[model samples]
Target chain A: AQSVTQLDSQVPVFEEAPVELRCNYSSSVSVYLFWYVQYPNQGLQLLLKYLSGSTLVKGINGFEAEFNKSQTSFHLRKPSVHISDTAEYFCAVTLSISSGSARQLTFGSGTQLTVLP
Target chain B: DVKVTQSSRYLVKRTGEKVFLECVQDMDHENMFWYRQDPGLGLRLIYFSYDVKMKEKGDIPEGYSVSREKKERFSLILESASTNQTSMYLCASSRGTSGAKRNEQFFGPGTRLTVL
Candidate 1:
């Protein structure tokens, strides 16, 4: 079984300031990580994913995250945020095992980012 | 671009009414999913179909059923609408991922259903 945890429920930051959204996961086997953003009344859009190799992953809209294996965390970071960056962000995990693998994605509760000017 | 389309933007139904939510994907993806979004809870999967007539129950499938008679379409059924069932329904699709293929799911605009 796999589960995702997003520590922060809401994050408020002034425009042009940096922000970090924390995520953690627990799984018995190797996993794939993903981040998604949802605007008002719209479906989620894929931000980025960490499949293998490089731990540091870059995503759209000047956002990036680092996958820390030791901590079991995949935190999303933005050097600076814009008013348009205010939205709900989610962290998801899928087990990538061979043979009888579950392709289903388990998602976090969500973090609401509010960028105020 | 991958496009996922839902049958309605909004719907209103009475209690005990049977409801159907239709979803179609144009990307020829092999897997389709139905999820419901609630405040602070994110999205909870109701059902998913990996191929035509193939279905799998997700984390929350108690109040819902699904149908996938064709490759490109998936339908979510609510046997009896209730107030708790009123939420934003989302449809998503992705190419079947196997052996390290990283396929991201594409989502629809969403259907907000109100059950009275």
Candidate 2:
């Protein structure tokens, strides 16, 4: 089984400032990582994913994440953030092996990102 | 433009009452899932189905049952609603293929269920 741990439960950052949301995972096998964002009263939407290839993966809204194999981390970062970026972000992972169907994702507890004016 | 729709946006149920949450996807997706989202707990899968008439239990399936009579629709049933089950329930669907791009799951707006 795989597990995800998001180190911070809440992150408050000023608008136009940089922010980073930490995520770490534990898995015996190679895994695929994902970041999802959920706005108020809405379901989650995919932010970005890291399947295989370059460690640094860019996503929508000028967000990016780096997959560090040695550290078992895929922390999400944004050089500059806007007020619209305030939302609950979740980190998830699934095994890389071929599953017969869509593999189940194990998610982190989540981090609430609040952009301060 | 994958769209996943749930039957309700908000639902109120009394304790001990039967509850059903329906989900439908129009993109002919092969897999459907039911998950509950609570504060501090990102999302916990209750059940998932890969094909019609086939269902599998997920991590937290103790208080839920699922039905998949058709490939496009999936339902989560709570035989007796409890206060503990009050949360945001989300439905998702994904392609049942063997590639990285196809692994993305599209989610519905979610149903906020409150058990009184």
Judging by DockQ against the true structure, name the best candidate: 2
What would the TM-scores of all predictions be?
0.97, 0.97
For the candidates in turn, chain A alone yields TM-scores of: 0.97, 0.97
- Per-residue lDDT for A98 in model 2? 85
lDDT of 1 by residue, B50-106 (tens): 889999998899989999999999999999999999999999998865655534688
Error of 1 at A43 (Å): 0.5
Comparing chain B with the reference, what is the TM-score for each candidate?
0.95, 0.97
For model 1, what is the alpha-carbon lDDT of residue B98?
Answer: 67
* Candidate 1 residue spans exceeding 4 A from truth: A99-101
lDDT of 2 by residue, B1-116 (tens): 99999999999999999999999999999888899999898899898888899888998999899999988999999999999999999999988657775568889999999999
What docking tier does model 1 reach?
medium
What residue pairs clash in candidate 2, if any at all? none
TM-score of candidate 1 relative to the true fold = 0.97
Q: How good is the docking of model 2, by CAPRI class?
A: medium
Candidate 2 DockQ, CA atoms:
0.71
Per residue, candidate 1 scores C-alpha lDDT tens digits across A10-67 of: 9999999999999999998888899999999888999999999999999999999999
Predictions in order: lDDT? 0.92, 0.92
